[model samples]
Target: MKLPNTAHTSRPWRIHEIAHDFLLEDVWALPTPGGPDDFPRLVRQMTSGSNTNDSRAYTALFEIRWRLGKLFGWDRPDAGIVARVPSLRDRLPADLLAGPRGPVFSSVPFTSVYQTDDEWVAEMANRTVHALMHMSWVADEGGGYHGQMAVLVKPNGWFGRGYMAAIKPIRYLVVYPALLRMIGRTWELQAAG
Candidate 1:
């Protein structure tokens, strides 16, 4: 299934810009703060829960990237950043490639390359956006915004039910805009302070 079109006209949360920014930051982040060893470490850190074949690794990595991006300053939730990590995963070394069925999972690596890139800024914005999008799950139902909590470990289903379930407030009216504003302001605050 294809994701919603994000071209011209009215945008979805202005997510297209966010996506572009995320990719730019990601390209740079990959080389500077996280190179060969660090990238592999990040991969291991995020893919710890599953057998590598499960798409859960992708989701988990997105979550970790979001947290790191926020801490660093990139917080836009861009589509490019979402696409980049997986691109990186697609290009992993032979030894690093592991899956439940071995060959079945080898085709997808380096998906993270879809992020935004600013040769000058080194994709910092893209990385931040990537991280924020992943963290949507935590911000949506972590008791601060919503009264009730869900205990869903695996957020994958036939029709994106799991994805929709996980991204409650981010997809809704309340939490997403707040996060966007807060993180965007944080970038300014960091610059000013």
Candidate 2:
């Protein structure tokens, strides 16, 4: 479910340190409720792209976005991390840096940054924005843990800001809801198996 921005900002996440300059674009409470040990399972499912592929709308949107990006040089090498903006990994604390870097996504564009017992962070960058996807295992009030995902972004400039604004409705209305349903169904199947 979509959550208030404060749901992320109010938390004492380590991501806040490195992403202070970025805006909190979205916060969501994932439907994958389970035990603490299930975080790795959740992260694995996400990185594996098991949930996002089922939606035709998502596929179409992504295809169009990618084509547009290619045609406009919006994802060109010169506009990515270390070219346009430094990587968030560069700001990782020594302890986080020493731990296992998170899993590399199989079907997504993001690169893993860090992983811990309760949290994982990944990053993606393009001409439009430098973005971070953070996932955390949080204990629910009803007892048991569920996943929380947050998106943070630093838009490139006016164009980036406009791009984000233009996509906000589509993201909230179609992409995220579809993804949530997929994740929930996938999690149910995994748990059942």
Candidate 3:
């Protein structure tokens, strides 16, 4: 479900240290309730599943975004990480760098940043923004654990700011709601099996 920005900001996440300049765009309470060890399963499901295909509208939205990026050179090589902006890895402390760099995504463009038993982070960048997707397994009051997802972004400049503004309504109104339902459905299937 869509959660308040404080849902993420109030947590003592290591991401806060590195993403000080980025905005906390969104946070959602994922429906994948399970034991603490189930985080890897969540990560694996996310990496391998095609959540955007859950609905025609979702697929169309993604296609339109991809086409726009291609046409406008928003995702061009020179516009990405280590090209236009320095990677968040550069800011990581020695301990985080020495640990296992998380899983490589199978379908998306994100690169692993770090992974621990309770938390995982991945990053991606384009002309519009340098973004981070953070997932954490948090203990629920009811005795089990559930997943939480937060998106953080540092917009490139004026174009970035404009692009973010234009997409805000669509993102919150359509994309995120569908995404939450998709995650719930997938988690049910995964748990059943």
The per-model lDDT (C-alpha) reads: 0.28, 0.90, 0.87
List the candidates' TM-scores in order: 0.26, 0.96, 0.96
Query: 45-112, model 3: which lDDT tens digit per residue?
Result: 77775443467787799999999999999999898889988888999989889997887788778888
- When 1 and 3 are scored with TM-score, the better candidate is 3
TM-score of 1: 0.26
Q: What tens-digit string does per-residue lDDT give for candidate 1 at 25-125?
A: 11001111222222232232222322222234445655775676578644444434334233333443343334221111122221222211110001212
Clashes of each: 45, 0, 0
Pairs in steric clash, model 2: none
Q: In model 2, where is the ten-residue run with the lowest total lDDT?
A: 49-58
Error of 1 at 149 (Å): 26
